[model samples]
Target: MLQKKLMLLGGLRYLLPVIEEAHNLGVYVITADYLPNNFAHRYSDEYCNVSIIDKDAVLAKARELKIDGILAHAVDPGVVSAAYVAEKMGLPFQCSYEAACILQDKSLFREFLTEHGFNTPKAKGYENIEDALNDVDYFNWPVIVKPVDSAGSKGVTKVEDKSKLREAIETAISSSYSRHFIIEDFLDKVGAQSSADIFTVDGKLVYATYSDQLFDPDAANPYTPAIEIWPSSMEQKFQDDLTAQLQRLFDLLHVKSGIYNVESRVCSNGKAYIMEVSPRGGGNRIAELQDMATGQNLIQNEIKKALGMPLDNITAPEYKGVWCNYILHSNKQGTLASLEFDQEFQSKYIRDVGLIVKNGDQIVPFTGANSSLGTLFLRFDTREELDSTLNRISDYIHINLR
Candidate 1:
């Protein structure tokens, strides 16, 4: 066994790659989270029962274990806390606690970009309906309102009228931790946009993959991602330009190591507006999808970067493939009596069936992808195969609710 011990602060869903790579590398992995049944904990050698938000407790535990390096790859909430432990222990961490805070919080990030002269959408942050309404004149209608810290499209609302502004602000603030919500001028979704996931070693770019989002405009609520497909169908130049912009941002931010997910949009005129940056890999099934489209093992590279080890060269695979994650959701809130997936589908490219909501569990009223029943991850050898499978899966699967 390796002498180095590594500590991870997120659950299995986020730490799947970290745990797998660390254990494979012969390092002792310690998984910590609030939930006892978290996915990653099941695969780890040792599990710690603690809340991800409890920074002091986590730091104390790290001291006891003498962890060589700490990481929070896909977990945004724990990134700052992870850096806290690294800073206190004088370990080599990628980003500072202040930088992590700015990246994790949308309001702070917007301000940072504005001050830094990075391309940004006009925006404002509010704590309540009154504050939001007081600044209503500052924003154009159809503004984007969302929780400053929430991810995966939770508590995102697009306000089109003055009457609905207060309600949107209330909903956004309710879902946030700091009672803060960001209201930004909605950008035109013309042309193309993609979420670029990149890895850097010693502040230099190593690997990258771009995923195109299938935006659902008329899905009642506007804050859902709906579906995301890898190696976006966009033109090659668009991808290269966006990558260049991200390279600049990475340099400016002084990203030493680990993964970074930058959500950017290519305007109709070809300008790329950076949406946000996370000092970690993307959530949902992005990492898994990237692996399918490209032969590169991102999870392995991320671990090597965090441990200060040299990573193998990462390149896009020769074959073209598509990986899609469909968010299953319902219009109403009720008891989730039962859930089932087609057996044939499971045996095929369908990787696994995961249900965040279980039988007899009460489902809440949700407007977007945040309240999904579960995620359906599909991989295919070709785009044609991917499209055909998506159509078939759409018709065959069922999410029975009561």
Candidate 2:
């Protein structure tokens, strides 16, 4: 029998686990992206140099390689391209190419949600700044400006004054590949935002989990998620409602078996809203952390689904203990920095530390997810201990610069 050939878009470090799982399954893994120096390429059976954002280019390469399946996984920019390639090749994919395009673009996604009667923020998408300025009155005060086609909060800004709208628009346009931006009413969350990876089989929701998504106030981009804790603080009633709504949305989209990264929040208006739902794994190791907390291997199941293999039984996760993933980052630019952790804290809570940079490496302010230094996985026996430690995180962990 021929070994199954799997092509993965984007060579980010997050793809390493996928590569490992593919290898274990006796599949030939090919990592493709424009960058040849990406770390995941080192582990893949082959590396293809092609722009993942260019669907035609990726399709041509996948045809040349004769791959059996393709996946974008944690990389957001390549989700549309991967879907296009998979559809062109008649391979297994989570959703259709049209569905992927709609989910990947913020403006299209918002319109779909509103049209489907789901609770969504009032938003407008614009290709130029003048039009958005003219329609400023359409939104409520304290709106969020963001790129329509970017992720990891790279081009997100909270604007209360209209005078700063142009600057924000420029930032959003610069970050967007399509040079488009969206202005939306910012829903003031009643508690920490919820983000998680959910799974569905043949358009039926099987597994769902939620986390408390936290942000660092001192970071350059305060919207970027700085930490995530499992077993969300949201009321059980809201969680249940969101899950039902999400399943309905998936059925409307005709989604197939696969994993999705979902973002949601309970607003101060005494309502719940689904903010974003992308058909790919979330960045910041969300699936990996979920695996540790629930003993469910979403990564492995995702791979199996991509390859058209039968998936293992995937059920709702029941977390054993409180878990948190702290995205390590700095607030200022510097060089030759050494990370410090309190000995007692490290011994008690820190389960693993995955550092991306060594001492003497240049580091910059935490403007986006790309600027993160590393991630720390922690487990606690009680929510009180988790809250107390995270509230005073600065006292336990420090990033010293030379």
Candidate 3:
């Protein structure tokens, strides 16, 4: 039998598990991106140096390679390109190229939600600063300004004062590849927002889970999720409503089978809003953490779906215990000194520690997902212990720097 070939669009460390899964299934893996030294490239069977965001370039390479399947997985920028290539080559994908474009671009997504009568924040997308500045009155006060096509909360600013709107727009445009930005009314959340990966099969919502998306107020970017706790504290009624809404959305978009990183919140206005739903696995190892908490391997199932292989029966993940994925990051830019952990806390709570940097390596403030140091997988016997420990997380874990 001929070996199946799979071309992955990005070489970030998040794709490592995807490559591992494909290899376990006896599939040949090709990692492609502009950077050759990316961590995942070291593990892939082949390396192809092509810019992933450029759909035409990726399509050319995929055609030349005659790959059997392709996927972007946790990489946000490459999702549209992957869909485009899959559509052009008549391969399997989560959605059409047009659907991917709408889902990936914040502006387009907001428009879609509003047009479809989803409970979305009032938002507008702009390609120029002058246009955004002129329409400040369109949004309610305390609006959020962000890049229309960027992910991991890069260049997101909360503008309480109208005077700071221009600076916020500049920051957003700087982070955007298309030089576009979005200004949306901030939905004051009732509690910690929910962000997790959910799966659909043939446009039917099959499996869903939500996490408490926690953030560090002191971090350089407070919008970037610092910790994620499984089995969200959100009320069951709200979760069910969100699930139904998501299924409706999938049906409307004709979404195919795959995993989607969904962000939702129950607002102070007594309504639930789906903030973002991108057709790819979320960064920060969200799917991996889900696997640990629920005993479901979404990573492997996603790989199977990508290759057009039969998928394992995916269902709602049942949490075995309270779990948290602590994102390791520094609040300041400096040289790494050492990581300090309280011995008793480490022995009891810490399940696994994955560090990307070593002592003496240079470190930066946590501005976005790209600046994260690593992740600490933790498990607690009860919700009370998890809440208490996380509230005083600094007492147990410290990232010392020079």
Write model 2 residue lDDT over 221-245, tens digit each, in one string: 9999999999898999999999999
Residue-level lDDT of model 3, residues 172-218, one tens digit each, is: 99999999999999889998899999999998888988889999999
Better of 1 and 2 by TM-score: 2
Location of the lowest summed lDDT over 10 successive residues in candidate 2: 331-340
What overall lDDT goes with each candidate model?
0.74, 0.93, 0.92
Structure candidate 3, residue pairs in collision: none
TM-score of model 2 vs. true structure: 0.99
Give the 10-residue window scoring lowest on summed lDDT in candidate 3. 298-307
Q: List where candidate 3 sits over 4 angstroms from the true fold.
A: none
TM-score of 1: 0.88
Question: Model 1, 148: alpha-carbon shift in Å?
Answer: 1.6
lDDT at 6, model 2: 96
Clashes of 1: 1
- Backbone Cα, N, C clashes tallied per candidate: 1, 0, 0
The residue-by-residue lDDT of candidate 1 on 14-125, one tens digit each, is: 5776687788888888888888887888888888887777789889988998888788877767777788888888776777777777888899889988888877888987
> Could you tell me the lDDT of residue 370 within candidate 3?
86
Model 3 alpha-carbon miss at residue 298, Å: 0.5
| Per-candidate alpha-carbon RMSD to the true structure | 2.9, 0.9, 0.9
